[model samples]
Target chain A: MSEPIAGAPNGEPLSSDRPPAPSPEEAIRPDGRWLAQVEAASGVKAGACYGCKKCSNGCPLSFAMDLHPYQVVRYLQLGQMDKLEGSSTVWICASCQTCLTRCPNQVDLPRLMDWLKEELVRRGQAAPEEKVRLFHQLFLKGVAKRGRVFEGELMAGYMLKTGGAFGPEAIKNARLGLTMLKKGRMKLLPERNKDRRWLKALFREPKGGSHA
Target chain B: MPEVSYYPGCSLEATAKDYAESVEGVCEALDIELRELPDWNCCGASAAHSLDHRAALNLGARNLALAAQGPSPLVVPCALCYNRLASARHELLEGDDLVIDEIKALGGGYAGVEVVELNDYLSSPEVTALAKQRATDLDLSGLKAVCYYGCQGQRPPAVTGKADYENPQGLDRLLGALGVTVMDWPFKTDCCGASHSVPRPDLVFTLVAKLYKRALDQGANCIVTGCQMCQANLDMYQEEIAKQMGKQVYLPVLYFTEVMGLALGIDETPKWLKRHLVSPKGLLEKAQLPRQTWERL
Candidate 1:
């Protein structure tokens, strides 16, 4: 019917940055505006969150998370970046969107959380373990190389990174590893490639690359 | 004159041969050429990567390289295969230079020919126009389906493009045209645990609960998916979930392609459909195909 309102609740993808690390006076609903931008971009949320916890009920990882989906939306809506900034909520999200889909207010919790996490990482407020960050880095890095992810090389690099980064934890999952290999699940190494230059050329903007 | 490089992945070759057969028929109807990549191996699917990432990526890379030998873009009907190939392509292109160099030492230059998920490949406006032109008069207006994208189709939206990586209903749109009703279910992209079901039935039960309950809650008679792993996991694990949860929730799962094939009126009940632990025969009823004559086909 009527153009489902062209942009997100607030508008289109925000071309602007975060609200200057939340000044106290401006902090009342600081994270709110930028998150609204992200919510708009995702085209899922039509407006800002009103602190509803319906998302928490279906969340698989709620107990393990430091910031609940509702809490993440609230912090952003309230301009509380300090709480949203160093939050473990982003990584804890399976990016499942269960909460967002179930939210009555149409608040896109994942997009809001991811937007905050990116801001936190970029600004050095959130110190994600270099090892854990490897997963995120590898995904983007794969895209920059092939205009898509190179699973072969990525898996190899990921394993090496995982083993190097989390020692025993990586090894502790060996039973899973054994199961994978038995079922022909494990690959010994990655295949080589010849199109990095073309892939980089195809990217609109290298997301994980250096500062803009 | 159109050609598609086909990567049957592991399932179509081993457990789902009928999918390959039905796909071959559908490809013919669509006038899309299906070429099997030479010497393609396992995609390292969920199994390879869970055990070892490099090996899985490399395994997927091997398939991409083989597809590269052909002129057509690779079309993988299975979601897991597509994600694996796409992920492999991403890694080979963006992975660490030193490690990539090491892989180069073995699998040869990956050639970097593009590999496309079957849905992504078929999703071009051109293909949609073609399907509209070729579909038989099945008039499937009543089939309510939960389009299960599984974990791969959407996610890291940065890679899969604008298709709402989560609740992608593009296929549903196509189905709607053929007269099917799509159910809005939240389990569209939840984990079916893939091949892990064999070794970890416990984990699968939880994931399966999420899948069936959502679809059941949505009043769907069947779940449509593009990934073989999704079908196998849901179809095979539903009973397991039933036994564990002590509740009977049976939702037939079918490859979205199979539904398309049936709706298009080529319903011989491709043998692979029978391979599924969950019965998807209700699709024929959904497709409204004349039961007696075609059942013999």
Candidate 2:
């Protein structure tokens, strides 16, 4: 069985040779003001964006958004968190980090974009969109139940939650769904074991729930 | 023997059980002790970054912490999971102002836990020496394979470090060790539309078609991958693509471990290879290993 998972800080175990990180209270806004009081702890840099627009280039859903990838970082730099989160720009990033790899400065625009999305979700102030919330819920649901995403089951569950599970559309997609089921692609009962209970305990027992 | 914390991710447990089995079998062969981490979470794999960023890091971090409970580095089998976890590790250690306090927020965080890819582990001289020693009468001379690294496996080479992000030829070397002829293919690390199949099947058909066209044109009998998502995308979505294209494209997808098993003759069986959406039974027949379909893995 897999072990009780830790947070992001636990993933990279740098040796003593690595340098220590900056404090959240030390971070400055793009306006050069001390704005670390309410800042969520993260390693995303507000600068280093070269304005190459590579992230938008690879984003599959970029056309559906109001702002582009580099633009999202620009807004964050200008201390415009409201616009960053209000628009669908951050939600559609795909978090593929394409721009991060291509950036001359190695700017992690996707990471910053993701941080903005989490803040919006935590504040319950996200734009009126079900896809973003549904995406987050599907991920957490998979983690809560079995600690991994069962794609076939997760999709149907997401459809059910988004209220796309019935009527003509459902009937139409039902054939595709049946094909999936017949292929042994879909599981009727999510394989739940005793370890799932231990996972829950580990998650809930973490200090402060580990979220900003 | 060094014991490393292993993350099976989601697919390996059930959907891709053979992968876990083969990995364990290989680990035993190499005397590599793999302690499956307890209370592990998903690596935030494909969807977490799109849904929420911190949650994705948080998700990756959680898994790292489970591995951090000991001195052993993380060994992830699924390339996608390794990429996500490794990316998360890179972010956490970048030492930006935010990571410092995020540590404080989550009390007593993992101070040191380096994430290692399974390919890095498998490609080690130690494991290779063991594989050579454990060699049986496995003749994989006839199998033609295209080593498909997929996007997450090879690219972002800075994060994965398993192979070159730009032009990875490591899998070819691994295949060479197994004595299988690998095709020179251009779309090795190309995108398969990834989890995009869930929301948009149209794009998946296009992506899979491109892959099939390139691999088939390059003379590959099957597509072998380190990612379960990629295997599923190529294997599962091809039928949908054929229906759309109004023709048949029968290029089966096989796991890299299965290919290694074929070469090493370690519990190689038709039933194990059959779970692939495309039955490699005929392909296995082409190789003609010693064990019948049922007597081995």
Candidate 3:
């Protein structure tokens, strides 16, 4: 049978990278400013979570995360920004919304995770799951250019940028790619939108008036 | 003929061409005229929401503006696109005036175009009645399927506004009306690791493998889904998952429209089935549905 927990492929224990739990003394001192900032930015009340663990229990990708879903919220509540910033939980989150769906408190954890990812990018912090961030960036770059994603180009860019062109993953998927090409599922050329001026304006940086 | 605006998102142009074709075939058979939204762009998918909030909303708002130019309700096939467009519309109308102003500056406004997920729209009483009327000779009893409604098709009730978000019966009810045995499985609203297939195939493989195993345990021969990404992930990674688990976990993942088209006896059904990574030919043949000729890749 497959590992029930679906351990990390590298054989590293899922909890190995998790930060140690806080002592009772440390837990009592709530980070009021940090909580206020997170709540204000994400519009989610992190304080509402009474450690129900429903979000973590329902999270599909929690097995691969360093900090569980509830832990992310708890860390935010306690002003443990360093642990959250360094955790793989934010990057590993697929934003599937299962956590938010099952949360009795109706806390929008997915929205908070999205905010954390943007914040990390703004602060120039390296994501634990670099490829995930790279994929998102590359995907958006394709959208900004042609107003639609060109699968062939995007795949090529991702492979070359990540140096996974001839990696095991590439070799494994080569047949899948060939089959898609044969079935006309992978287009050879990119489709362009007729009017791209508005799309271009949307991608432009507001403060410096520079193109992204 | 009933008319509605169609937003075939970026995936339909390539990766999900089969879904696009099957959707068109099914819509045509049901006498539904789909008006293609002119010059429609991408919905920015998960990438935009993760990196830039404003951009995600703006991208969705722009599409809504174009969609508003044509019809009252925009029909979106891809669940991810449906979620993005629907969520964006929700934010634009209710959140604030920032996106409204941005769209206005771009020569558009929040026209408040209603966006509906295609499966939900098709399961409506009118469409179901039309399908039932057309499927008089159709017999899909040979196929037993678990309707997988991968996340985003219906979730975050505040956005999609699905009354049965937890246990959506849209696909089950639609397939039941067509004579297919739709199994009541608990994995209906499970996430298929959307977009993580690229960066984290292992994660997707794990999630999809569990889904395949559960479907099999439920005595299902195939899985039917409405989202292109879910269909692709579940179908494409089966062999890999099977190899990893050292077991026979072959389950044909199909688009709901393809099944509907087959039941309705649309000629293009075989053509659509030919494009799937894991062919559902055996199951169909067993059911006495039209035999499909496979294309050697």
Ranking of candidates on lDDT, top first: 3, 2, 1
lDDT of 3 at B269: 79
List candidate 3 stretches off by more than 4 Å. Answer: A1-29, A206-212, B100-102, B105-111, B292-297
True contacts kept of each: 0.00, 0.24, 0.80
lDDT of 1 by residue, A1-212 (tens): 23344666775554455556867775464444655564554333534566657888777656556877777766655546577666666655544546655677666665555555555655655444343345555655554444333443554577675563266745534544554344333444442235344333323353664421
Q: Per-residue lDDT tens digits of candidate 2, residues A38-94?
A: 233435665656677776786645655688887877666666665665787765444
lDDT of 2 by residue, B98-182 (tens): 2323333444244357777676667667666666667665667667888887777665657765446756776677776777778
DockQ: the better of candidates 1 and 2: 2
Shift in Å, residue B214, candidate 2: 1.7
DockQ agreement of candidate 3 with the native complex: 0.62
Candidate 2's TM-score: 0.75
Best by TM-score: 3
Clashes of each: 41, 18, 0
lDDT of 1 by residue, B17-136 (tens): 455666777677788888887756656544334323444565666566667668667888877677677767766776534233333544544546666777666656777677777777
The sequence of per-residue lDDT tens digits that candidate 3 reaches over residues B32-72 is: 99999888889999999999898898888888888778876
